[model samples]
Target: MRMVWKTMRLRHVGMAFFWACSMLTFRSSILLTGEANTPELESIVVIVSFVANMTTLLALAAWAENDPERIDRLPLWPMAAVVVVGLVLVHFAGRVGGGALLPFLLGGAVLTGVGYGAFWGSWADCYGRMHPARTSFYVPVAFLLTAALFLAVSLLAENLSVPAIVLMVPLPVISLVCLVHCRAEVPDGRAVPEGGSKRSLLAVGSLIGLIVASLVLSCLFGFMWELTVFTVGSVNEAHLAPLVANLMVAVALVGLVLYARTRVNLDIAYRIVVPVIVVLFAVLPFFWETNPVALNIIMSASYGVFDVVIWSLVAATSYDFAVSGFVVGGIVRSLSVLLRLIGIGIGFLVTLVPGKPSALIVGVSLGALYVLVMLGLFNWLRHKRKAGAEKLEEGAQTDAFAQLDTSAPDEISETPGEEDAAPAAGAKSTDNTMPAASAKPTASAERADLDDEQALYTTIAEDYGLTRREAEVLPFLARGRSAKVIAEALFVSESTIRTHTRRILEKTDLHSKQQLIDLIENYE
Candidate 1:
């Protein structure tokens, strides 16, 4: 256990480091570009970013669903592809300065979009498949660490352009290294099964709902990113910008840690957190002109914390439904990614509207949408709970009958002297039966009766038929740890872990680590 914990801690540290580097690179580039003076250019850039991210998300969903095993097996080909394409397009677009470059830029957007889409989805699948149990802990830890690292890097890279870009280059390289280390882990196929049926349709609907929820949240976050950039430029005191952003990131990290330790329900977190986000964004415009600094700080903290929780929810939920294997899992994830892309496009369109307060309007609109979806999801979950209980009860009766048939011969073979013993045994069995029969019904009747803490976990287990060990390992996987780290921590050999992982995939019918992670992250 100690070893497992140690390995997990190390993995978390690595994730933080990688994320930090990525953030530093990304933020520095944005800062260098500065806020576009022209609304048209700003809109164009935002659209490009949105398109790039969306394309990447879609490709990721497909890859995770179809060829997940390749995630770790391959080097950072996809990452390299995205960066190379982006740089090339940016260079050519600058050089040509005409209609001809438009296609190139659009193509670049598609490349980056596809690359990142795959990257994010794959990352989720990998983590969920590898460390099913610790999805809540490791997933957030990895992201927080990355955010912190990136913030620090961004602070240092603010002044140096070449060095900053060069520093950023290491992120893809490091990601590649991690991928190499992950090769031995094997794919855990936990995607939901493919086929059209009432149950399948329900799964699809749930996936769509999740996607819609993500779309609203992503738009809000994207707007927040833009707001941060705008705030940095508008404020005269430049030094304060990074400080405020860092502080916000810190607060968010702390909140994530607290939530992980507490194992809070995603629903409860959404109920509490979404409202706060809405209120904060709604009031943000009031401060933008008068008290930008303080408002920026507060907004950063609120938005950052909300994002962390939201990402965790996404990871958890994805894993829950990923049990059907990659085909269904991929479709569900792809749809979600598509919705996010649509949301980004919508956000871009909103920016095109005439007004200085467009960002504010977008933020408020997103918040309102989030509230509505969250409320609907909460209500839907309540209904599912009732239905799930009824199903459990029905299942229990069937299980009892099957057991009785199988055991009848042994019972009848008992001698006359054993009749008394038989009755006692029968009485014991009856006692056990009553609870078994009542368990599902009771769980259905009361939401509190369900182990909501394990709602995501159990869902994945049921969907994929995961064994105890596989379920336990999933959370670590999501954290992006190497097999060695997992082995050391679990007090098992890497090969043992790999074997178990293979079984998990076979049982769940999934294709890749990213699919698994995405499933857990976005579990209903």
Candidate 2:
């Protein structure tokens, strides 16, 4: 936990500022709610802003795909400049007069959205440098802090009104500065590993099963958004929906902290998302007339909880594959936003349904959710079976390795020089597969090589001052095994393996696991 803070505190500030910039500038439901004065115009601006944001994200992905190295070359300050200009335009849109208003708002929306997209790409780059284990904690804490900061800024904006745009103007620059500091702390050019495109595809393909599920969830959220905006009478009440939702996310994050600390076996948040959504939507129709605000609470909370889950998955996936974060984040986030738009369209379409519209929405949402749940269960079962089979195979291999006689003829294992020497006259070899005369020397040579490698690992570990656990992890890393394989071998969590791997890198002053392997391979 202390390690997490030490490495990720700057990231927390950067991420919070990025999120707060979004809420302050374009997301109409939060700090900027009603500030635009022209509600109709504000809606147009918000929609266009999101569309532009999606397009910009897709474009960045394309750009990153064209040359992953380009990410490291691109300057951060320019993006910051773009964001500042766009923010100024957005902030002043409401204050300007008639003929200039539309153009100003439209331009500002484009720039803000574009800059927001750029920032996401940059964050993906940053997250790629971090380990998935640390990111699980880092991403959530950043968000929780973002929510708290938004709450404070929103309150200040409520009191100061139009002048609040002044408060938001500097956040982007500050965020950029923090990101620069973060980048300085971590090594660069490691984000785009070899064969990044293939790895990115594999990562995305692995998560494809969750796409429909995520889309359904977002659609349900849009349905709730539509209902909240159109039906709720008070502007404040309508906006409270997002506020409550953010708070719900904060609560879920606290639970996530507990799950991490306690090492809970249960999948605390994601698995329960469907059930909670079902129950909330089920009760929505009943409360439609009496207290539609309840609808706001339920859907917002669901979206918030799901948002954290999605972000964590994104971070973990990027970390695991060591692919271009820009590509992965851009693809997933772009699709997510696109789905939310489609869901909003569905929200609009449901109004045309005959009789009880709320009931129709609830019914459709629940049906889709039910299908998603079933698919998830099937996938889980298949994965469990496959894991069991893999465990069996691993056990067999471990037994095979254990059966090998490590001792060489003539006590060859005693010292490097002795190991290198030929077996004493007439010594029998352990292997039954070959003739005794030739096998004795060959088996001795094989054992010598193994012992030599083990000795190299020991020297490297001691020189790097690796901890006992890290030293245990080092040999597997040198042999080119992944964090998962090492974790299985050590009977520890994958996160623990990653943590030890990170420590090894830090102590050795190396940039990556590949570097650590190279050090071992090239040792004299």
Candidate 3:
């Protein structure tokens, strides 16, 4: 058990390391491309694009909720078809550049949105069902890896456009493949007969709250992206590249590290991270007129941290919601994205108003908005928790404990039975009572509870049928730790970690780290 625990911890660390590296590379490349030419145009385009993406994502989320098993079984080809259509539109948009292109742009935007949205939604749903805890960890790791990849690509872009793009595509594709591999491990709802009465498709109140929360978060992101563009564009060359790169890398690394080190409950992390993000945003205006280099870097790091936290929480929570409400989870996720797009539109419109507020003012206002939204979400989550607890208590009082007692043969036979039953009853009573009777003290009960928790973990581990090493590796994969970090932690080589990961995939029947995460979140 100790070895197993150690291995798992090592795996977690390694996953974090590798993912961080990748993100750093990827984000750096994006920064190099300098996509934020016209603030208004960029914001508008992104808003439209995100809306489209979010809608498709939401649909995918819904599909996962309703039919995760089917999702697992299906190949990526169908989904790839959607992506191809979007890419084709993008190609056409590149060709037709005039007032006549508005409709085409809109069409392209929707396609892009749907294509990515479907994949994103499905990814979240898959992660929730397969590797829930890892979902949070890997998110940061992925960001870190993307950042790293961005930086690497940026440096090499002049000479290696084709190679860079090829490399970039593989990361997500590999992630997708991991999901495919883990399909068998995903819990099938069909195995457990549905017992509830037919009910409304939507959980209206919860869904509304989620959408609102998503909108606020999305707006926060959109605003931050705009700020980044503004700052980077305004800054001088000597200071710009290093500052942006550092900020991107720092944020990813910090988020990854913090997430790995912390063991807070997912809900608690959500509450904490959201408030911090808002506070950071609120203060952004103070530095707006300062050296563009310094301000941009700081804000980027802060936003980076915020993004990691928010995405992790969303990924985890959405999975939980999906399990409880199936189809509704997807709709809620999509609605959340839509809300975000709406917020972006509002922000863009606000910016269009003459005398646009300084970054700090915009940041502060958005920060305040974030706080308000978070408060609302906190309340909602609190209520959900309370309700769940109450239900569990009720269940314990009515059925669970009684079932436990009834499972004892001695208790059953003692009621009233034949002469032959006497010996059997005596034996049954002895067998049933010995373990419980021996475990009588407070400490014993505590230990028993710990044992129970371990048992639960073990049971979950068994469901994945991971070897002790593979189980250890599972969390690391979720955390997005690098192979090197994992190796160092495990006191093994990086190649060993890779080998373990390969076997882990085979054992769990998962294809990607994301799929493993989905399984953990949903079934565990």
Candidate 4:
């Protein structure tokens, strides 16, 4: 029961169902329109092209992610509501008959894209802000659900009239449920702290670029699915495809969950899964006509893995060091969707060529793969360098810790000229081993009897704009440590500690170290 409770997240699962339903709602309209003429789905290409979802989608993604207002607080529900309305409008419009097709496609289809942009932008922000760690499981589960939804749309929409409209009812209903459940969110990992980070995504360099590039390439895989289904009009085979797809998604999710639970290194998974999937996507489709079911299984399995990795990256990027998760994650995910829409648009154009040439598909796939492979290698190399650098820093810190014991005194040698002074009138020096004549500094005037108070440190630090490093130093000051002791312990110079204390004093408007200590006690 504990394991189940730990692994199962209602919001994640519900969001998956919600997102799938949203997509299916939009797709149902296409199915309804395609049913009248073009039994083979040729005019469906016209629907996609005429709507031209990519331009607006790309624009919306850019606008939504970069939108300054969303940075401070995410308006998740309102955005989702917009998405629901957009998809529902498309659904209702799909029920419109032949003569009404032009107006509906011209108007409703774009609204559906608009709705998708709003929902995806906000949801992607949520993923980045709240679900960084859970990405491995929820992503695949959502995708698997999406596969199930697509399969349902393919099979049920064969009738493509009232039944299709009925099928869409659940899409918004599930989304509304998703909205309700999302009121409470599990705490997110790796988010930019409140008030935002010190640096921007551009400051983080190639990492963001790499994540965006990989996601765009993954869109090619999605494009191929659309291309084949629309061009071939193999709705029956496509309908059955999701069964194997969902199964593969389940298997992949299990492995990912195990990896998540066990805390295993994902390096090997990263090195292999993406590249292998890219190869399969490029090569397998040629044979899709011969073995449609097998092709679907492969596609499903690839999608399962790809979705997990993709979302994980998005979440991680959202929580990237020194940057706001909303801006980074939102932008990256939005770009991914925009690129995907563009890829699908390209696929639609490809099918327009005589006989629907396979070469163009292969060429596009390979080009995407090649770019991804190169970028993956680049990212891998950079990651290894970063890990090595962190290890070195930890090793250095460990050696510094080894040299000093927790209770050790700040040596008189640390303070030049201290040996010449006689004991203070009332106070006593800690090390009696020093000459009885050796001087003790009075409390307020000079002596900092070291006392590091950890608990009170955070409160004090926050009250004054202390950075994380400065906050760490605050606790050591509470223990009444001299600059020398604190510096040695922190592996820094006494001068640096003096600088920090000065800054803290400036921020707190305190007169001296003793005053700061007194102020800290009140907070404690």
Model 4 deviation from native, Cα RMSD in Å = 11.0
* lDDT minimum window of 10 residues, candidate 4: 436-445
Candidate 2 per-residue lDDT over residues 181-241, each given as its tens digit: 7766554324434676788898777667665567777777666666566565333446555
What TM-score would each prediction reach against the true structure? 0.62, 0.73, 0.59, 0.62
Give stretches of model 3 more than 4 Å off. Answer: 1-41, 62-67, 73-75, 88-96, 99-104, 158-178, 182-215, 227-267, 291-303, 310-336, 359-524
Residues 414-510, candidate 1: write the lDDT tens digits: 4454434444443344333333333334334465534563666665664454544577677677676777899899776799778776676666567
**Model 1 lDDT-worst window of ten:** 30-39
Ranking by TM-score: 2, 4, 1, 3
> Residue by residue across 134-252, what tens digits does model 3's lDDT show?
55455655566545554554456445644333444344445445545433344331211132112214233444543454446555554544545454542123223643555465464
Candidate with the greatest TM-score versus the true structure: 2
lDDT of 1: 0.51
Please provide, for model 4 over 286-398, each residue's C-alpha lDDT reduced to its tens digit, 9 standing for 90 to 100.
87556644544565466556555655655545543434444554455455555656666686677678763567767877887888777778777988999999999988866
Residue 492 of model 2 has an lDDT of: 72
Between 1 and 4, whose lDDT is larger? 4
Model 4 segments more than 4 A misplaced: 1-9, 25-95, 144-162, 184-213, 234-239, 258-271, 285-289, 292-297, 320-326, 352-360, 380-524
Q: What is candidate 3's CA lDDT for residue 62?
A: 47
Q: Which pairs of residues collide in model 4?
A: 422-439, 423-439, 449-480, 450-479, 450-480, 450-481, 451-478, 451-479, 451-480, 452-479
Segments of candidate 2 deviating more than 4 angstroms: 6-8, 29-39, 160-162, 233-236, 262-268, 351-356, 384-524
